[model samples]
Target: MHKITIMQMLEKYPELPPISQGTVSKIEKQFRKRGHVRQLKKNPPNKLSDDQKLDVTLMLEENPHTSSCQTTSALNISHSPFSAY
Candidate 1:
């Protein structure tokens, strides 16, 4: 019938491991803001689409030992994606 505070929940559950109050508050705040407890999806710095990866693979297979600069120039892709290989 009563809502339990974060400290009370921690106190009631002896099986629960101890954590910093600050950490717990931060996590609770994040859950309230996001409506979920999971971490946010991280965007890769230089993510390549599946199609682009396949295209790069095929290009490399066709021209083995090709330089990264050459591959980028040939595929019209940026140096970052080519350098990832």
Candidate 2:
């Protein structure tokens, strides 16, 4: 019986998306160790809450020309939601 290598399997499938062989090896290693292929998604630490979102929206509605910096400063938060982009 022949053992199919990562490179050999990748080469066998030509239409697969471009990915480094090293990455595939790491994923295989991670799955073996953790029994999962993907890591848990961590929520952004600086994400705005519903009330904060409403505040920003209301502020914008009051003044369309208001910048994110101005809105964030008025809302008493340091991080700008726009800055994340």
Candidate 3:
């Protein structure tokens, strides 16, 4: 409500984490502008490109029984993506 204070808003939404008045104001402004509050997509710096992913899939198809570590080592890629599978 226009008449409600920030403290009143906080009390009304007790489930929300403790936040600064500035943060709450920013959130309210963003919601008013966009009609929703959601974080922007953040792509991982080391995420494989489409070509790299295709290469990995082809490698996996060729050697279906290879361990994740072995496959990563053979492909010269980090273990994170391979381990995710």
Candidate 4:
């Protein structure tokens, strides 16, 4: 059996996205103590899904001249799913 340090694993997987050394060390220590690490999923509660939010962001970005009243109306229409009880 082989025991590998995170620094060694990171060196071998440099192509992975970069995280601060301190954050990585903290996660590693938690994993060692708990025998596993729980990661935050790409999605979170109380927020619109990525695709839905992206659509609204792009719409506003491409039409920066849109009025606040028009944006509000569009948002109300697009997010009508939440209006149902």
Instruction: Please give the lDDT score at residue 40 for candidate 4.
Output: 47
Per-residue CA lDDT of model 2 for 1-85, tens digit only, reads: 0125555666887788656667777878888898998777988767777887888788989999998788888888666564662
Comparison by TM-score, 1 against 4, better one:
1
Ranking by lDDT: 3, 1, 2, 4
- The Cα local distance difference test for each model comes to 0.75, 0.74, 0.76, 0.62
Residue-by-residue lDDT tens digits, candidate 3, 1-85: 4336566867888898656777777888999998998986888756676776887899889989988778778878888765654
Superior candidate under lDDT, 1 versus 2: 1
Better of 1 and 4 by lDDT: 1
4-85 per-residue lDDT for model 1 (tens digits): 4555767888688755667777778888899988977898768677887888899889988988788778877788866775
Clashes of each: 0, 0, 0, 0
List TM-score per model, in order: 0.44, 0.44, 0.44, 0.28
Q: Weakest 10 consecutive residues, lDDT, candidate 3?
A: 1-10
* Per-residue C-alpha lDDT of model 4 across residues 1-85, encoded as one tens digit per residue: 1234555766888998655667677877888998889864685334455665665677779898976557647765443432221
Question: Which structure is stronger by lDDT: 2 or 3?
Answer: 3
TM-score of 1: 0.44
Model 4 segments beyond 4 Å from truth?
A: 1-6, 17-19, 40-85
